[model samples]
Target: MCKAWDRNMYKLRFIISFQVQLIINFKLIAICSHQIFL
Candidate 1:
């Protein structure tokens, strides 16, 4: 039971980090596009 809980925690952390990375990438693209427009 402890092992299963630990595995779930790890999976949650992985998903959160992946989402943060995706948001960062999207912001970078937006900034680049804004610069191009200017």
Candidate 2:
């Protein structure tokens, strides 16, 4: 039971971190596009 719980926690953490990275990437892309247009 303990091992399963640890695995789930790790998976959840990974998913959250991955999502954060994606958001940062999108923000960077938006900034670059805005600069190019200006």
Candidate 3:
């Protein structure tokens, strides 16, 4: 049971970090597009 719980925690952390990276990437793209338009 403890091992299962630890695995789930790790998965959750991985997902959170992945989401943050995706958000940063999207923001960077948006900024680049805006600069191009300007």
Instruction: Give each model a TM-score.
Output: 0.94, 0.94, 0.94
Off by over 4 Å in 3: none
Q: What is the lDDT of residue 6 in candidate 2?
A: 100
Candidate 2 local Cα displacement, residue 4, angstroms: 0.4
How good is model 2 by TM-score?
0.94
lDDT for residue 25 in candidate 3, whole number 0-100: 100
- The residue-by-residue lDDT of candidate 3 on 1-38, one tens digit each, is 99999999999999999999999999999999999999
**lDDT of all the models against the reference?**
1.00, 1.00, 1.00
Cα shift from native, residue 29, model 3 (Å) = 0.4
Error of 1 at 28 (Å): 0.5
How many pairs of residues in model 2 come into backbone collision?
0
lDDT by residue for model 2 (1-38), tens:
99999999999999999999999999999999999999
lDDT for model 3, on a 0 to 1 scale?
Answer: 1.00
Error of 3 at 20 (Å): 0.3
| Colliding pairs, model 3 | none
